[model samples]
Target: MAWTKYQLFLAGLMLTTGSLNTLSAKWADTFSAEGCHGDKEHEFSHPFVQAVGMFLGEFSCLLVFHLLLCHDRRRPVPTVNPGQSFNPLLFLAPAMCDMTATSIMYVALSMTSASSFQMLRGAVIIFTGLLSVAFLGRRLKPSQWAGILITILGLIVVGMADFINLSGREEHRLSDIITGDLLIIMAQVIVAVQMVLEEKFVYKHDVHPLKAVGTEGLFGFTVLSLLLIPFYFIPVGEFTGNPRNVLEDALDAFCQIGQKPLIMLALLGNTVSIAFFNFAGISVTKEISATTRMVLDSLRTLVIWAVSLAVGWEQFMGLQVLGFLVLLSGTALYNGLHRPLLARIPCCAAWVLDDAEEQASAAERERLLANNRVVQAGDDA
Candidate 1:
């Protein structure tokens, strides 16, 4: 079928989303990767600092874009009026969720390899689907349910890979790896909740994605920064393997940022990339659907996987390969890409046939309602 302009635009946006996220992941890894980061690396290994940088970057991106590009009222862009659209306080809850999820993910990245971190995030789709069903009262189609099952199978495959890899490692290191993986999973859950809340509340208010993200950035930065004050005075927690005392680490991170040129650049780039990627992600959700955003995110995993391999951050692993393909396939299927190919197979054609019949019935019902309304109008006349 010929693509509509809308479809083409969405395709462009999807490409932007995938490319930017991939770049962000790579830059994030590079800043923290000891082997890949040159002689001039710093103590920015803390996820909290990275989260702070991203929050700052997002707010900057929104404000700069508004000043430079959005001054023209006729231009087609999501101009946000925070005063009229929604209460500013409403964004704080979701912002906290976003900060928690992002900070944990960054910490996980430091502990785990880049590819593992990316692949583990595939579980977010599974979480989102389950939450939608439970909290949003969303009923899934059979195909979507099938996709969910496949996704779960892929998650199992990936988890098995983690276990297999861990089995060969030292006891202490294995424990750390397991802990990091668990953190990544927890981060996914937090983000899933954030997505659902945004879908239910923020999206309904007609708040522009840019505005919503900016507001989130504002709140996240403020809350996270304030929360860090106690860390500066007292060691609330330590990074399991690394010698990361909260107060000292935070201070060291700032000093390193100022001292190292490459570290500063990486931090700046990561901040910018994250800001743009997040904006695109919100736009994808608002313009299309959250489901499509999740589907496209799998593309980012592919990018991170390839880059991680190229950079020697991760070695080739058969189980990860299998899990990635399965995860990607299931994601595509849920987005309705498998329908045409599956319909050609005799075994899977039944679902396609049923879907077509249902569509036909719905069309017939609408036609009858239109005719009945027309006849009723004539009788009234």
Candidate 2:
């Protein structure tokens, strides 16, 4: 009935990460939309700034994690033989992928409601499954296929609902809303690609989770820095069409921060949260299972939705609610959550869980028998 300290620590990390992640979206959208630094409006719209912040934050977190590891006597898995375990050159792919995905998502956040932005990410599970089959030659169970279908349905429902809402609005641009939603979806696909590649290569390479992320963060930060050179010359939004000088928009954002103390605070919070989100995410994956991490990610979506509503950024929509339920159901089924629950139910126990249970039991029995034979051979010797 009692949890170990380690368990409590993990739970705390998850809670902190989830809350910070949800609040990051809220703060970002709020400061961008509601004005920053005491002004009634944001002087300039710059999701690029968030993109910049991401690399910096991730890099910062990486430093802290590396330092903590150094203080410990235990050797890191990937650090035992750095050249053998991890090649710095191999970090390029995921780093590029991270930059692309992070940039797109931040821009999308400015365009869509936090709830929709979060909900659209549910597409990642479906994408990951398809990617695994195509590249890894992995086969799926029947229930997993069913879950994929359900998840696809949920994606359609949510997209359609957003479209309907967009069409009903006079001021909203159909192109912008659709584009934004598409960007978010596209980012999920990239993320899925990154995950699959990491799973295949990084794990085989024995790259420690934190090390891989830190390396990627370093690469991503450098790349983003280079990209910002060109972006700095771009005009700030559509206001005066003046070309943005180096740090022009960031300067404006900071000046606005001077006016609104809370905006500055929120900005700081967003920076820290983004870092913690990455750290906690990796921890969850390593400590628990990847499937559990996926479930926790969905829980984070719920937090974003609730916070969005509480803060009056979004209204409850029946279609959105239905779509969320479908998404949740699909994720559960894909992750095999339903099997245990179905087995507990009296009627469906035989229908749904029996086959899976039988297969698991058979495989376990075979393993034990093999071990017994090995023991008997040793005794005979």
Candidate 3:
């Protein structure tokens, strides 16, 4: 189907805001602000507070959902069913997953370059596929397996590129980057679990996409906001640069945000961008295909990398470029977007399914796509 102007707008919005979500968070971490306990300057490393900003942005979706619902209610036929009932607490588990994954990724972002952070997120595709097989009773196509393997190789190449750039003098920096990248990959596993949980438990109720996102946001924000209290009391060896030498010094984070205008702006940008990103993402899935959404997400990674390079956040590496191309190829292949190319190959032709399998695959994709329209935005977890 040809995309309309509105649909194209949604696609662009999704790309722009999604990139901003990571970029802004990384930007927030770059500033040095006054410590809570002293006049000494400490870097803004408040990943938990940053996560709260994200959830707040997500909570804004609840406002938007209500506005849209009211508008729909005025129409002769309402798009949202008022009678649809599911306990709001159903979101608790997925919200917990979102909280953990997002907080860890933000911590990782504080240590790594923004470009690397964006690229590494593609690892979610691998985790999501494997988890689907294990828990969802799904069988993979051969092409999908090829894609997973290629993606793994791409990840290794990216990590190697980071390692090669490290000077002996920068050994500590190297350790941070390596640790950050590994943490990001681990977080993707949590994200995959969130997706599976949403598909199995939440989408089955046919909940509205906006409501799903907003409800999850509410739960995530409420729970994590409370956790920040206990986190202040917990001590950690690393990230002791803050005033309290604790895991997450909430008071220190607040003091930092209050002191730095740029930091506050970045956090605000991160929050606002996420809300719009979810809206555009859901619209893209509804108006176009999930395959298109996947393609656009890949483009977002490129955009992020280019912006990072343009802004001198990191130096350009030829090896990293090669890795990105391989990663993109794998992403496309896994989504079956490379079927035409596969069909053209002599030996690999069988991987392109016959009519019967093709029909089944198409049906399965449609069903998943329908669920995705409901669950996609919330998976921003």
Candidate topping TM-score:
3
Pairs that collide in candidate 3 are: none
The TM-score, computed over Cα atoms with residue i paired to residue i, of candidate 2 is 0.79
Write down the worst ten-residue block by lDDT for model 3.
Answer: 347-356
Q: Mark the 10 consecutive residues where model 1 has the least summed lDDT.
A: 33-42
Model with the higher TM-score, candidate 1 or 3: 3
| Per-model root-mean-square deviation over C-alphas | 6.8, 6.5, 5.5
Tens-place lDDT digits, model 3, residues 40-72: 888888899999989999988988988988999
User: Which candidate comes out best when scored by lDDT?
Assistant: 3
Predictions in order: lDDT: 0.71, 0.73, 0.88
Any runs in candidate 2 off by more than 4 Å, and if so which? 32-44, 74-85, 234-255, 258-261, 285-289, 345-381
Error in Å for residue 53 of model 1: 1.3
Question: Over the full model, what C-alpha lDDT does candidate 2 score relative to the true structure?
Answer: 0.73
The local lDDT score (0 to 100) that residue 347 gets in candidate 3 is 78
Give me the runs in candidate 1 sitting further than 4 Å from their true place.
Answer: 1-43, 68-70, 74-84, 236-244, 279-295, 342-381
Local accuracy of candidate 1 as per-residue lDDT tens digits, 1-381: 565687557656655655544345445445532312233443346567777877886676558546644465565864644334478777888888999898888877777767778778877877888999999987677777888788778877877777787787788767766777889888999999999988777765656566777888889888888877775666546553124444425555655555555766666766777676776676667767776677677777777778777867667789988998888877776667777788999998998889879878977996899689889989999
Candidate 1 Cα lDDT to native: 0.71
